[model samples]
Target: MVARSFFALCLAAVAAAHGDHDHDQDPIAGPLQALWYNTLPGDGGTQADSVFSGISTFGRLPYLPCLNHRGINYDIAFIGAPFDTGTSYRPGARFGPSGIRQGSRRLNLYGGYNVPLDTNPFNSWAKVIDCGDIPVTSYDNTFALHQIEEGHFSILSRAPKTDATKKGPSLLGKTLPRVITLGGDHTITLPLLRSINRAYGPVSVIHFDSHLDTWRPKVFGGSPSEVASVNHGTYFYHAAQEGLLRNDSNIHAGIRTTLSGPSDYENDGYCGFEIVEAREIDTIGTDGIIKRIRDRVGTSNPVYLSLDIDTLDPAFAPATGTPETGGWSTRELRTILRGLDGINLIAADIVEVAPAYDTNAEHTTMAAADSLYEIMSIMVKRGPLSVMDGEKEEDL
Candidate 1:
């Protein structure tokens, strides 16, 4: 009886202490309250907060597994193509992918630039992952391009396997994740187009560069014996010849370079491209340029946007193999990209970012990263993965 009374008293004492304890002062309770009440940090988290906070991928997202890994699916993948051997002037573009990734560290995933874009691209609009770099051989150009094509094929093949008999909208028929390539140089676009053509057929291109890139192949380095010698300048010519590009619909913007001859213009014209010279931006203005692009590409065509860093004037983006004296300013480029909200953006790349020429501030790389973010925003707004069942085709 005496021991039972003592135990009862002990229980009563424990209850009194529990009731008197300050929840705010309690370590476990305080953290729980903070979880509910604290403002979310913009840089993902503080350095000491989580190991993942410091890990680097584009936008600091988790690394994606290889496509062959069973049951894995991604809506978008950032793949690096780090080859510069095809460059005619400078060669440091091999470092472009790394430089762009490094520059992206300053960006916050939660807040995108305030534009007319409807939603934050990373806000569950699509599933995005970094697939890392496509391995490229430094010595063998032909073999390297083949490897890039094969790597891209592997990523596209990951789209969910569908019924061969089924038919519908091209966007709905797609099962593969869209890709954003960080380039070694502009030559990488040829292999990229080859991969995309296998699935979406010949796509319309939105080419932005200081040079018309459609110069005759032989002018750069091609010969009858070496017909395959495709440099950055001649890839689009080859792309058009191989039936990998929609001739009449494709357009080139920001061209400022002197052509090899009048025949270069004739060649680009024969390829079915309309040219918008860099100086034309001052005359036509941003809205006019946007209208021209939209009218040319239309809503149904699957479009690939290729941005060469030299499209920006050397004053704005100096870190390129071929810097032009007069080109679009960073603001002009960003605004133009912002205007392309509803077009069907299947795949895109930002190329020719040779970091070796950048200033101590890395301004060129930073501009490239911002341009990539803008493209991603456009993709989120128009990509098939983000469309609803009843969504209008124009909205997509």
Candidate 2:
């Protein structure tokens, strides 16, 4: 199964590289893209049963685990990591996953396209399921970290391992479960890496954030020992040392500030990353950032994307605990993400959304939601959903 999936992935990647086309008129549309509510015969109601009558290809919510017309499972789970214990400045991110889940139900399930929104190496199969939040405490950072890790371990274990004697929770039941984890803080990524390595071997990380979060163990002041505090400030060093992420694959896109101890590492010569500082994005543009990211992660590895909400400027995203001055604009982020239309993204997380910090929950949560949407788009772009074509023939 693993070998088959890998082969399929390779073929998809080649297609995405060569099948590049314009979006104005789609040559390929599948059942998922079949119109459901576009100008009904006589009914112009606002609800589903009335406005959404008929057996359109799109599945109903509480989406069942069934094969679609494209022959893929409906697998995508929304898992939450409520551990702000690592947050440096804010204490409200523990509430992030729950809020984002609530917000998600309020929007269109597929961004109005039943076909996967991803355009590269067009994904032809993926099943998305919202598995709900990972259970953990708010104040206990260590406990929260453990809980988040365990939850993702379950997610990564979605694919059956021949080494294991018993059947385990396989991703979307057949493939790696496409997980979009809602974060408590940047530190939540440590546990997540543990799981990804277990499931797919050591994978590369494509990190996007404001601060580097690579402060050495025991470097943080609040902790009695490095293990004592484990604040959001210390994920990279922990993961790098632990062999969870490839430093070469780890690209830092929006760093504007420095940790008390990690200055020497960010120096272009010191760190093996294209540390594109916040202001440079405008002058350099997202295309450069995307190229740098591709080079950093390499086209072959399955990349994990982690978005620390602080990567955005506080003016645009003020809900984070740490608000940096210069950061990526929403449009800038969208451009970069859209450019990565076909990379095989295994899992993604959005961290540091402190609802308590903003006047209107401006920064963290909203950006997290938008960031999640981008991730969702990325998943569909890289899976079987990508190449699935021919929007259901207008309900015959």
Candidate 3:
């Protein structure tokens, strides 16, 4: 009886302490602020006191395991493909997605505004969210490729919650959401293109890289196994063969890599891409390059943009799978991307950013993040492709 009474007193004391202990009050929960704000942090907490703090998503966007979660739809979703076995040179590009997100922490700190485009892409009409990274297996390259394709297709097929009533674009009588993938390597584009082709048919490509990436497997020197052929160097060749690319409508910008021979250029042409050499930025200027790209791709067809970070000069972005000298400055590339504001950009990727090779200042990852920000702005400005337009049809 005495021990039972002591236990009862102890329990009462614990209850009293629990009842008396005060928890820290939420700053935004004050009466006036409460009227304007909800429990969910505005701008995904980018406006937090420190930029370096918090879970990192691109531009500090909201993170959702969108693939695993049903009914969580978005107009523009950011998904990471973190497989790098397809890389021929450097191996750390599997970390590209996290590196790019870390670099993008400051993108929306100032209300997510872009003075050049005169818009805040984050606050725009589209429902933008970070879909988190696709769980790609690193064990097998072939299985990883299929995993990426299935993961991307899962997100792309969902109907988005948009600010506008009209659906952006459709192919098989269903409206599709847009995807901005943080890449594993240039090889990731092949699977991405396959998934996009299912929804939009063959898409015109705006490929920005230091290499053509369209080399034939034999010419590029792959093994006897067919699976061995699909590396970063030759995914576009496979994309072309798979009928995923719109022939005669694709373009490659910032190419400056040395080839095996002149026949490599011939092969690139045969794969249906017009090249805007990196050296042309000096001779024809950014305006001329932009015009060439716009003229080649036009404005109505669905286009996929694959950006390899090596497209920037090593002086600017040294941390890539293959760093080539004498490429475009980040500013030059941004200007050209801004000039492409009205094109029908359906999906895009920023690839080959190997942060292990980056400087302490993180120039390569920053360049990749900023370039993706500009692309997002352009997409927001262009809105979505209207379903009724049809002038982009060309012979395949």
TM-score of each: 0.82, 0.71, 0.86
Among these predictions, the greatest lDDT belongs to 3
Alpha carbon RMSD to native, model 2: 12.8
lDDT of 2 at 388: 18
Candidate 2 lDDT, tens digit per residue, 237-343?
66766777655666778888855644546543233345667777777778888887777776556778988777877777777778888788876886777666667
- What TM-score should be assigned to candidate 1? 0.82
C-alpha root-mean-square deviation, each candidate = 11.9, 12.8, 14.5
Task: Tell me how candidate 1 scores on lDDT.
Answer: 0.79
Candidate 3 has what TM-score? 0.86
Clashes of 3: 0
Looking at candidate 3, the ten consecutive residues that score lowest on lDDT are 24-33
Say which prediction, candidate 2 or candidate 3, comes out ahead on TM-score: 3
Top of the candidates by TM-score: 3
Per residue, candidate 1 scores C-alpha lDDT tens digits across 84-194 of 988888899999998988777655543443455665565544777788888999988899999999888787656532222333234346445678999989999999999
The 10 consecutive residues of candidate 2 with the worst lDDT sum are 387-396
Clashes of each: 2, 39, 0
Candidates ranked by lDDT: 3, 1, 2
Question: Which pairs of residues collide in model 1?
Answer: 159-175, 159-176
**Cα TM-score of candidate 2:** 0.71
